[model samples]
Target: MAALCGLTSMHKIWDKLFKRGEFTELDVDEEVAGFAELLRERNARRVLDLGCGAGRHILHLSKLGFGVH
Candidate 1:
């Protein structure tokens, strides 16, 4: 299973599929962990998560002390 809707370059397709909650079976903890590490390295205090459907990433970012919008 693809972490975030496979390796498809076209994000719109994945966005549509994800928004409908079609790909909930995939595990993305590793990806999230890597992203959190990157944010910490960059000292990311704020984030603008556009197209943040379901607010999964947003929630994680919030927990990491990022002011997500």
Candidate 2:
């Protein structure tokens, strides 16, 4: 389908950008910090990052003591 092809093209573009070190900033956004707080409040110890391009959130969450994958 055209939609599927478009998605694949987008994926390739993102992969290239990631390889070039784009979107690799480690600074966690305020919203993510707030979400981390909520997770902590709930006693959540782990996070699954399904599309963790450049692993920014994974690293941030790990530093905050959550196991990130």
Candidate 3:
């Protein structure tokens, strides 16, 4: 379908940019940090990083030992 093709095209663009490290310095903004704190406080063992983009927060959570997906 056209929508699926559009998504594939977008994915290719995003992948190219990410592979070039264009988003490596993406900020772990206040909201995300707050979420991380909450997870830490609750001793969460797993997290679902929905729409994780370049994976900044996912990587952060993973470093803190959560089973991030």
Per TM-score, the best of the predicted structures is 3
Give the lDDT of residue 19 in candidate 2.
Answer: 92
lDDT of 2 at 34: 94
Residue 38 of candidate 2: its Cα lDDT?
A: 95
State which candidate, 2 or 3, has the greater TM-score. Answer: 3
lDDT string for model 1 (1-69, tens) is 575555565578778988888856434478887998898998888989886465677777787789988
Model 2 per-residue lDDT tens digits across residues 1-69: 999999999989998988997887778889889999999999999999987466777788899999876
Q: List the residue pairs that clash in candidate 2.
A: none
| Every candidate's lDDT | 0.76, 0.88, 0.86
Task: Please give the RMSD to the true structure for each candidate, in Å.
Answer: 8.9, 2.6, 2.1
What candidate 2 gets wrong by more than 4 Å, as runs, is: 1-12
Give the per-residue Cα lDDT of candidate 3 at 2. Answer: 100
Candidates arranged by TM-score, highest first: 3, 2, 1
| Error in Å for residue 21 of model 2 | 1.9
